[model samples]
Structure formats: structure tokens, C-alpha cells
Target chain A: MTHFEPISPLSVLDPRDRGGPVQPLLTIQGLKKYFHSAGNSWFGAQSVVRAVDDISFVIHKGETLGVVGESGCGKSTTARLLMHLIKPDQGEIIFDGEKVGIDIPLTEFRRQVQMVFQDSYASLNPRLTIEDTISFGPRIHGMYESKARLISHDLLARVGLDPSRFAGRYPHELSGGQRQRINIARALAFNPRLLILDEAVSALDKSVEAQVLNLLQDLKEDFGLTYLFISHDLNVVRYMVDRVMVMYLGSIAEIGDGETVFSTPVHPYTKALLASMPSMDPDQPTREAPLSGDPPNPINPPSGCRFHPRCIMAEAACSQKRPALETTRHKKSMAACLLQNRDTPIPFPPIKVSGQ
Target chain B: MTPNQALETQPVIARSPGYWHGVIKRFSRNHVAMGALIVILGLILMAVFAAYIAPADPIKGSMLRRLKPIGTPGFPLGADELGRDMLSRLIYGARLSLLMGLSPVPIAFVIGSLLGITAGYVGGLTNSLIMRTIDVFYAFPSVLLAVALSGALGAGLTNALISITLVFIPPITRVAESVTTQVRGLDYIDAARASGASSYTIIRVHILGNVLGPIFVYATGLVSVSMILASGLSFLGLGVRPPDPEWGLMLNTLRTAIYTQPLVAALPGAMIFLTSIAFNIVADGLRGAMDVKS
Candidate 1:
């Protein structure tokens, strides 16, 4: 929201187009994953859930790109697709300017990219000791046992875990936050260039979340790594990422500099998400949800614009014609909406918060 | 190193005891299971040392001492219908009984688990193909299937063991496949896959540790079932040939003398019941202790 925070007045931190033609490290084109539902009855039609449908984006080296959306928006699915955990029905993922697929070999792409899952306990094998869990990636990728063991202990120490105290402990013996740290350490064990964290910090306590976020920033700087950070918390995303991508029912609704998107959000769905975040200011008045009712079922999504059913600005044309993502005058902020109305440019709404 | 880094440095901590230790500790607490385990251990020791521990030669039958009562001189538990030393024969029978019960289990566990883990992890067409084929064996009651197969294969200890092993396989596979299916969806599996681990590696290293415990516990339960079936095979004279001191065969041999020497005749039956029940209680204890959910 325009008046949501004191940081809104600050300019964008994203590396812009004016910064001398830099090529993106990874480029995704037309990705889609549709899950076929079981038959309703003996003869009922099998519906399909469009988990990720027709999305494209690029990530540059050493950049932290945050993906935010409500549940069922396919935020986690996108991460799995990048990791190649689940095959996309249709898409081409171009990494380092080369087409990455059957020919280039997935193991080569996987060696460079690693993902940290949201549920920490579920992400670590319950049977493995902390040392084995961390070393599993390296040992399988051809590192010798002794060298891998040394690397695992080094990673444990780097992630703030005392190697001697924590190395032999299993996942069940550790707390939620400690396990999350181990998850991060395991991702870094492979010496990956790109780390995709799918809601990695969303499960931690407030204080632990801050510590983890700080650890991530330090790791990114030290390792010179790029991150595709996914989270539901806009506040944390605002503090951590360079650019942000807002998804709605598996399609990108807004993409731009993190500051611009969070401070002056143009898409209707993005505005609603910001409003949903609990404000610390007791004096600030609560704003009613801009759009109500659960998101349309993904199995049979609404026609045209996926957000049309809940859109307050929906028009007759909204139901029949989709709006393409277009850039604004800021050169960084972009949104997909039929209500651009350039002359007045749909006045940016003031968020009801105390600091304003 | 920096000060903060040094401050967070962990000291060497003693490694705690592992999962099996906890299972043993828990099992020790269950009195029924402990008693059963003790009995089972005794039975195993008897089976191992039967040649030395037995009071007299088990095979030689004496016509003058035929049907000797309990506490008779030269016969500790008295003589059997053929005037054979009952104590010696029962002790010697321990080896064959345990052999019949346990021999089929490990073979079935290894083969069934392989089929199941593979089918479950590889899901869809391969899963259907393997599982459906295994299901054909599942169509009949396990005992009936064992009996029919062994009957068709002809009577003998080897044929009985083979048929019983076949009978246990489908159920073990079903359990392994279901448990594997459940473990297959956990986040660590996807994490392992993303780490560039091959499917084979996933099953052996990652999935095996988690699913094997529950499957093994389930197989322990099958051990008792296998023991009973093996005894049944010998009772019908399809296993452990005559005068070999097999408990089941002894039961068959002593049936005619049941009226005249009732107490002596009941000894073999009592041994069969106690051993099977001991195995069953032990299986129950192992299940409770090995339960990962708890």
C-alpha cells in the first residue's frame, strides 16, 4: 500500500535495464503443469488442475527474486518445476543461455541448482544423522567420503550449527528452527550457483525467521549465489529480495522491483495481499478485504482473466478478454489489468495504517 | 575465525544410543514380550544343542519299554508310543520346528520387499503390472494356498518350505508397497531426487531406511504364522519324514496311544502351543517397540 511503510519513498533497488546490457542466467519460457483429477463417478469426466499455466520469467546471477501468492496459486509448484521434481507438461527452461532438457542432461542443471523446501522436518530424512543428511548430496555427486565429511562439518558450522554438537543428531532430535538451518546447510552443501527456497522461512518463529534471513543474506554475499525466494510474507519478501513476482491462480499478475511492487502495487490482487498482512500499529484502522470469497477452483477456473470473479473493477470485457502484463512509466513497475485508465492512472489507494 | 563464529562453535557431544536400542528398551519393559523372548531364546538354544542336551537317543525305539509312564527309570519324561525317549525326541524336534518356522521368512522378506519397494516407488503401469500379478496369489486364504501348492508339488520339508514362502510373499509385498507409497511422498524424497540421486539410490539409501523398519516388524509377525503353517504341513505327514522327531510328526504318531498314555501324548501338543504363542507375543512386543509413530 502507498502509505503501508516508511520505506515506500525509497527508489527501486533492482538492477535496471539502464545498467549496460546484462544477460539473465536462467530463462523460462511457457511453463505449464496440469494434474488430472480422478473420475468423479464411474463415468464422470476427469478434470484437470492447472497448477502452473503459461508462465515465463528470468533470473540473473546474484539476484534474489521473491515469488508471493496465496495458497493454490501454484507458488510451491513453480519451485518444484525449477528443481525438475515434477515435470512440466509444456515448457522450455533455458539455463546459462543453453536449452536445458533431455539433451543437455538434467544432472548437470541439478548440480548448479538446489531447492530448500518449506516443511523442514519433511525435507530431511528422519533416519539420517545431521552429518549424513548434509553429506548425501556431495557424496553422491562424486566427492570422496573424507572430503565430503569435512565439507559437511564445515557447512554445519557455517549455518551456525555446532558441528560436534549437532552433526550426529537425527532430525527428530532437533527443533523446527534447527532443522530448517540444516535444510539450508544441505542446499549449500552441493556448491550450487542458484538456490530456490520455497517458503523456507515461513515456518520459523519471528526471531528465528530474522536470524535465518540474515544468514541467507550473508550466505548470498559470501557464496556469490542467486536465489529464487518464495514466501507468503510480503514484509519479509520486501526486506530480502531485489525483484518480486506476484502470482494469481498460477499466472504472473505483477513483476517488478521489490520496492515498487510492495510500495505502489498496481494489480488488484497484489493490493488485496498487502491488505491481508497484519499491521503492528494498533491505532491504524483495519481495511476490509478488497475482494472476498475463496479463489475460484483451479480445476475449472473462470474464463478470460483468472482474477475476474473477485475483481471489484471487473467489467463485462473482463470476462471475455485477458489483459497482458505491460510496463508503466516507472520503467520497472509492471502489472496486468484492463483498468489502466492512463489519464488519471487509477489513483494508488492509501493503506489504512498508523505511520501515515 | 571471527569472535561471533567462535562463540557459536559447538563442542563435541556424545552420540546418543540409536533406534534399535530404544526398541530393545521398550520391548524389555513389556513383560509379556520379555517372557516370550526368553522362551524363544530357550527354544533356539535347545534347537542348537539338541544332540548334546537330549537325555537319550531320540530315534531308537524300545519294544519292552513301549508306552512307559512319566517319571519312569531311564525315561525322564517317560517313553512315547514307540517307547522312544520323549524328552530327547521333543528337544531334538526343536531344531526341525524352528527350522521349518524361520527358514522361509528371510527368503520371503528379501524377495517380497524388493518387489514391493520397486512397484510402489515406480508407481502407475509398472506398479499395476507387478501388484496385479502378485494379487493372483492373494485370491485364496494363505493356509489353503500353502496346502494346495505343497500338495501339488508333492510332500517333503523342502516343498512345504517353498509353498509357505510363496504364501507369505504377496502379503509382505502389499505391506511394503503401501508403506513405501506413503514414504515416497515425503519432502526428503523429492529433496533427494533434486540432489541428482538416481531412482535406484533413492530406494536403497533414502526409502529403505524409513520403510524397512515397519516392513520388518510386519515380517516378524509373519514368522509366527509361518511356524504354525510349517507345523501343520508336518502334522499331515507332508513334511519332516517319519521318526525324525518333528513335533508335528510326533503328534501324528502319538494319536493312537492318546487313550493309554494321555499325558505323554499331550507333551508335543503343549510344546507346539507354547512355542507358537511365544513367537506371537514376541512379534507383538517387537511391533509395539519398533513402531515409528510412537
Candidate 2:
């Protein structure tokens, strides 16, 4: 197996290199994933589901990048691609300074970067106990039984579930939130630099969600880890991530520093997402919430912009021009929208930089 | 090497007592299975100690005492047409009956499970090829297939064992492949892959444990069918040549005695029925215990 630089360039912590365009630890260049949808009947036809349609982004070292989108918007697909769980058809992912596909085996990449799934209960092997679940990767990767067990106990405690009480228990014995905590400990077992949470805490109650979020923050700081946090809850993303990327049907709609994107969303879909958050105001009207119609079948997306059909502020140009992500004035983040780049009837300021 | 990979390697912890204990507890709860298990175990011991258990030499016959009634002097279950001790022969028959019934199950289970798990995991072309081959075998009625195989192979103990083993492989493979396919798509399997476990390790540790339970229960159900088939082959004179104390062969030899000693003629058939029933009940109990839904 060829060696790529570790997913996190630990050497990049030099004091002299403090302030420049943050050299992203992981760079995903125009990744695309398409699934061939099989026909239902004997004589049926087949078509492609463009799951991750030529999307690209960077994950800065030690920063949590949140991915927010509707149910089928491909946020999880992007996470899967980054982890090498699924191969991307049309792009490359470069980690640290080395390109992943060129030198690294998928297994090697997995050691540096790991994932925690959405359904915590489903994610764990029911046949294995908390200790084995946490120690499985380390054992497979060649950790000693005693050492892995010791580390597992420490991690279990770190994740806020007492190791003595929980380590011997099986997955089914635990509550959803407890199982998710165990999931976090197991993901951490391999000492990955980047951890992808694909709606990890989404299955828990609100109270449980906050506690897990807090635990995650502590673990991140303690280990100096980077994260790809995917969720549908805009509020959770705002609280947990340093920057946020909002997707609309297999493409990025808007992305920026989390606070700025949440405050002033450049793309109409992002704006709609922010408005849709359940509000304290008793009189907040239905029209304010943007998501209504089911996502158009990905096998045959709309003419140009995939989100055009559901985009409330969409104009004739929106359906004709396939907007590419462009640099906004803030410079760190980008968005893809006709309104972001030209003078139109829309209230948002006209763009000087065109979305390619 | 990665740091985690560089660490001292160790084997996974052994399965805990609770795991097997739980399965045993669940199995024990099924009263019919428990009863069947006891009867089968007892029969197995009888087969193991057939020499000590049988009162007389099984094949030795006295022309002087032919067709004697049950509870006749010095013969607990009396004598058959050749005056062979019915009780001794039936006791001796347990060994052959069980050898035919029990032996083929494990052989089929191992072969069928390997084929099934392989086809299921590899999928697409491999799956279709193996499963279709099994389907062709399945197209023949199992009894006809066993009889044909035994006849073609030239009947005897080894031929009968081979026939019964071959007859079971197709359906067991079909069940194994389907269950394995279902398990391969489960989230935990994907999680294992993402954790960098090799394909072999994943299949062994993750997939095999889950699939084994269902495959075993199905294989257990095959035992009864195999025993009956073996006896059928012997009754047809294709298995155990005459003078062997096999249940079916004994039945074939005692056919003329039915009118004079009706109960004696029925003994071998009763043994076949009871053995098969014992297997069927145990299999049913195992199915209930292994079921994930319960």
C-alpha cells in the first residue's frame, strides 16, 4: 500500500504559519457519485440517481464543518465519499498534502478518518458488547487486547458513560443516547484525526442531543480533532460547527462561516432553511418556511438548477443557468445562485463575482 | 503503518458466557424441543452403546423360534420371521438409523453454508451462478433425487450417506444464501467495512455469526428427512444388504410375518417414525429460539 500524508498534517502547527488562507487538511475536488437505479419489472428501464453531482469543498484542520440539507440532498453521500465508504466517479480527494486515491488504500484512509452513522442502534453490532464494539477496530488494526481494553474504558468514560457500568453491556440494553455515546467511543478507538458524524445525534431527543453535542465538543478539543458534522437541524449545525455548507438536491446551495450564513443566507434555499426553523413567534406564517414539495426524482432532475422546482424565489434564469459556487465578498465561503451573481428583482445585493 | 496498526495486535475477546447461555436458555424454554432433545440424546446413547443394550446377537436367528410373539421366553420383544431377536435388532438399528440421520446433517451444513455465504457475499454473477445450479438440483423431488443418486452410486452404507448429504445441500444453500444476502446489507456490516476490517474478517466475525444461527436451524430440520430417506433406500433394497439390522432392511425381511404377528411387523416402522419426530421437534424448537424477532 502506498502512503499518503496523514489526513491531518500534524507538522502544520508551526507558529509562523498562523494566518493565511487556511490550508485545508482535506480537499475534495469536484467529486461525483452516480447510482444506476435498477428497474422494478422484468421489462423496466434503468436510469441514474445523481447522488453527489460534481460537488467540491475543503475541510480545514481542527475545524468542524457542518453539512445541512433536506432528507435526500446528498449530505450523507459527501460524508461517505470523504471516508472512502463509497467510491466517487468523477473527482479526487486530497488529504494533507497527498492525494488519497493515488497513494492511499481505502483501509489506510479509514484509519486516519472514521465515521459514526445516523442510527446508533443499527450502527453497533448487536452481538458484540460495548467493550468489543469500542475495541474492534483497534484490535483489527493490531492493538493489544489489554491496551485496547484500557483505551476503550478511558474513551467510554470520556464520552460520559461510566465504563464499569456500560462496557460489558450489549447494545440492545442501552437507551438511544447511551448507545450513541458508545458509538462515539468506538469511532474514537482508532484515534482518527477526522470524524464524520452522519446525523449521529439526530436519532436522540432534544435533551439528549444537547448532552451529546457538549460531549462531542469536549472530545474534539481534548483530541484536537476535525469533524464533518451532517444534520438537517440548522440550529444544531449553528451550535456545533465552525463553518456550514448547505446543500440543495445533490449540490451546494450556500456555504460560509456558520454565523454569517445563518445570519445572512445568500442563496434562496439556505434562506428558506433558516426560516423553516421552528420559531418562538406565534404568528410566523407558513409561506416563510421554504421546503414544501418532495424533492424531484434525481433520475431526471430539473433542466438546469436541480433546486429550481422548489426554489421559491426562482426566476426564468434560475432554470436555465446551472450556477456554480463562486467566491462571495466574505471570501472564505461560496454559494451557487443566479441572484448571488447578477442584478435581479431579488432583495439580496448583486454579485461582482459570477458563479461559474 | 498507521499508529493503530502499529500497536501490539491481539485477538478479539472470546465470546462471553452470556451469549451461549442466552441461546441455551431460549432453547430450553421450548418444551417440545426440550422433550425432543432428551429423547434424541437418549437414542444417541443407545446407538453409542448398542452392543451392551441389545439382549441377543442381532443377526443370529433360530429356526426353532421363528415368528414368536412379544414378551416370549428369553425375548423381550419376541422374534421376527428368521427368529432374529426383534428387541436386539431394533436396539442395534438405532446405530445405523442415527448414523444415516445425524452424519449427513453436519456435512451438508458445512458445505451448504460455505456455498451460501460465498454466493451471498460476492453477489451479482457469482450469486446467480451458484443459486441457479442449486435451483436445478432443487427442481427434482428430493426423494427422487436421493433415490436416483443412491441407485446410480450403487447402494450401500457409504452410498446412502452420500445420497442423503447431496439431497440436503441444495435447499440448505438456498436458505443460507438468502439469509446471508439479507444480513450483508445491514448497517452494522457497512460500519464494519468503514472500520477497515478486511472482507474475510468481516464475513467471519460479522456475517458468519449472524447467518450460522438460521442456517443451523434449517440444517437441523434436514435430519428427519435424511433418516426417512435412508430407511426408504434400505427398504427398497438399495441400502444395507439383507441381514444387516437396519430398521428399513429389518422391515423388508419381516414383511411375511405381518399376518401372524402384526405388532412385530410394525416395530421397525415405529422406530423410524419416532426418530424422525424427535428430530422435527428439536428443529422447531431451535427455529423459535434462533428467531431474531422473538
Residue B55, candidate 2: C-alpha displacement in angstroms: 2.1
Candidate 1 residue-wise lDDT, B1-294, digit = tens: 997565456455436567788788889999999999899999999999998899889999889899988899889788998889999999999999889888898899999999999999999888989999999998899988989999999999999999999998999999999999999999999999999999989988899988988888788878778878887888887888888988878888888989999999988888888888888788788889876456
**Window of ten residues with lowest summed lDDT in model 2 chain A:** A1-10
Backbone atom clashes (below 3 Å) for every candidate: 0, 0
The residue pairs in collision within model 1 are none
* Best candidate according to DockQ: 1
TM-score, chain A only, candidate 1, equals 0.90
Index of the highest-TM-score prediction: 1
Go through the candidates in order and give each one's C-alpha lDDT: 0.85, 0.83
Report clash pairs, candidate 2: none
- Tens digit per residue, CA lDDT, model 1, A1-356: 11111111103332222232265767889899998876563477888999998899998767899999989999999999988999899998977666777545798888778999999999999888898899998899898878787788888878898877788788888888899999998998876778999999999999999999999998887666789999988899999999999999989999999999888788877887777777778887545544466788999988888888877666788898888888856768778877754555544433222210
Chain B TM-score, one value per candidate, order as shown: 0.91, 0.91
Relative to the unseen true structure, what is the C-alpha lDDT of residue A7 in candidate 2, on a scale of 0 to 100?
A: 27
Query: What CAPRI-style quality would you assign to candidate 1?
Result: medium
